[model samples]
Target: MATYDAALVLLVDSSEAVLLQHRDDQGLVSPNQWSLPGGHVELGETPEQAAHRELFRETGLTTSELRALWSGPWPYEAASRIR
Candidate 1:
């Protein structure tokens, strides 16, 4: 079994609208889909680091503040590689 760690950011506006990504149709993974902003945790990086990195890389937004929500083992299958 292979274990992969990841991080996600649930960006919400003042009106409580959550920001999501409309994945590009040309992508190899979940193409043309709506999802949260995040990606896998890279080497030597914590989940929080990965989360912030992914958020900026995908949405070009930056936040100087972030509260820890949750962190634990997730029951995700790596073979399917669902983002």
Candidate 2:
């Protein structure tokens, strides 16, 4: 089993529209797909910190307000089996 920590940010607008980014076709993961702005948590960084960092790095946007919607170890083995 392998464990990886990651974080993602969901940005909503006043019109109730959500923001998403298209991954580069040449990218390593989920190429040419729409995804929320986020990435893996860096060393010595909390998930919240990583979320903020990833949001800024990917979208050039920053916010002081962020709330966790979910946090836990997702059952990777079961998820992989579904795919």
For model 2, the superposed segments whose C-alpha errors exceed 4 Å read: 73-83
Which residue segments of model 1 deviate by more than 4 Å?
Answer: 72-83
Itemize residue pairs with steric clashes in candidate 1. none
Tens digits of per-residue lDDT for model 1, 11-43: 888999999999999865467999888777777
Model 2, 1-83: lDDT tens per residue? 54456688999999999999999998655679999987666679888998999999999999999998876543333333322
lDDT of each: 0.77, 0.78
TM-score of each: 0.77, 0.81
